[model samples]
Each structure stands twice: as C-alpha cells, then as structure tokens.
Target: MNQRAMIAATALTVMSMGLLAVPAAAQEKEKCFGISKAGQNDCASAFGTHSCAGQSKVDMDKTEWKYVAKGTCKDMKGLSADEAKKMKM
Candidate 1:
C-alpha cells in the first residue's frame, strides 16, 4: 500500500477498535454511591446540589458517587442511588 493509504487504514482500524472497546468498558463499571473522596466524585450528585464531577464538598458523601466496578459496590460498602437518596432526606 502507498504511504498515505497505509496511514488512513491504520487510523480507521484504531478508531473502530476504540469504538468497540467503549461499550465493553462501560458495561464493566457501575455507579457506586458514597465512595468518592472530597472533590473527586463522578458526574453530579444524588441530591442534585451539583451537576458536575469533582464537586463533592465532603468525602464519602452519600449524595456523591463514583463509578465502581460492577458487582463490587457491596464489597466496597457503597450505597445505591435509592439508598443515597434516603440518607439525604
């Protein structure tokens, strides 16, 4: 293959591989509440006080959450979305 053609083919192959990996990675993680350190929480809070990641004012806040590996939340003693909501109430 010509130089430019080889580069294009390599880029396309890499892009497709990355796309295929995303869903599989996503499936391997789940949102685990009350596990993140202060200002280290992922994407919003259960109480709606913040709408962005890394905004938790307190460590291990029930309203804040991080994505933990699937089936490991209980092992980490992390709360579910419903459980976190009840704690905030």
Candidate 2:
C-alpha cells in the first residue's frame, strides 16, 4: 500500500478498536446510588449539592451515585438506578 493508504488503514483500525472498547467498558459498569463514600463519588449528585465527581461530603449519601460493576451494586447494599430514582433524597 501507498504511505497515505497505509496511514488511513491504520487510523481506521485504531478508531474501530476504540469504538469496540466503549461498550465493553460500559458493560462492566452500572450507576448505583446511595453508596458513595465521602469525597469519592463518580459523578454529580441528583439533588444538585455538587456538580462534579469526588465532591460528596457524606458517606453513603442517598443522593450521591457511583459507577459499580453490573449486578454488583445491590450486592454492595447500594440502590439500583430505578430504586434510586424513586427514593426520596
């Protein structure tokens, strides 16, 4: 292949690999609420106390959420996404 063609192919391969990686990573995670430790959350709280990750001030706060592996959040005593949404935080 010409240099330009080779480069295009390589770029396409890399892009495809990256695209494939996303779902695999997503499949390994789930958003679980009421389980975050103090200052160790993965994202913002539903109640709007914070707008970013790692900002929780209380441990196991019901409004805070973190990414846990699928099927493991309930095992950790954390609330599922639907349950968390219904919970009165």
Candidate 3:
C-alpha cells in the first residue's frame, strides 16, 4: 500500500511540472509574423502596403509567401482579391 502511494505521488508531481510548461510553450508561438526580406517584398507587391500593413506574413514555400490578415480582415471572413482591396487595412 505504501509503495503504491509513493508511486502515485511521484506521478502526480511529474504531471504538475509538465502542466507548468504549457504556458511558456504557448508564449513561444505568440509571434505569428515572420518573413524573409524577399518574402516581404513579394507580399508588399501582391497585397499592396496599405492593405497588408500589420498583417502576419509567412513564407510557406521557398518562392511563395502569404500575409495572414486578422482583425478587420477576419470581419470580412472570405473576400476575393478585389473585395479585399476595397477593405480598410
């Protein structure tokens, strides 16, 4: 009985320590925008600086990049290229 209790206590302690690590791991992923200089130029051209400003940019492929629009863009939800251009960035 004592051996079983000790084993359970040890498992609980290990699980608690792992739980404390979750927040730190989540914070590391908070930065959503990270793009190379070339990728930056491409996005700026494709979306235009006014529309793409403050949006998350990422290079999904070596030669291809994307700007992830948030906030106002999210309101529009799904917009075509022309519709997106008309939106306030």
Question: Which residues of candidate 2, in runs, are more than 4 Å off?
Answer: 1-27
lDDT tens digits, residues 1-89, model 1? Answer: 89999999999999999999998787878889988999999899887899999989998888888998789998999998888778878
Best by TM-score: 1
TM-score of each: 0.68, 0.65, 0.31
Q: Write the per-residue lDDT of candidate 2 for residues 1-89, one digit (tens) a residue.
A: 89999999999999999999998686878889998889999988887888999999999988899998788988989997678778874
Instruction: Indicate the worst ten consecutive residues by lDDT in candidate 3.
Output: 28-37
lDDT of 3 by residue, 4-88 (tens): 9999999999999999998766542111122323335234333444344333244322222234333332332333345444543
Ranking by TM-score: 1, 2, 3
lDDT value for model 1: 0.89
Root-mean-square deviation of candidate 3? 11.0
Question: How does model 3 fare in lDDT?
Answer: 0.42
- Clashes within 3 Å, all models in order: 0, 0, 0
The whole-model lDDT of each prediction reads 0.89, 0.89, 0.42
Question: Ranking by lDDT, best first?
Answer: 1, 2, 3
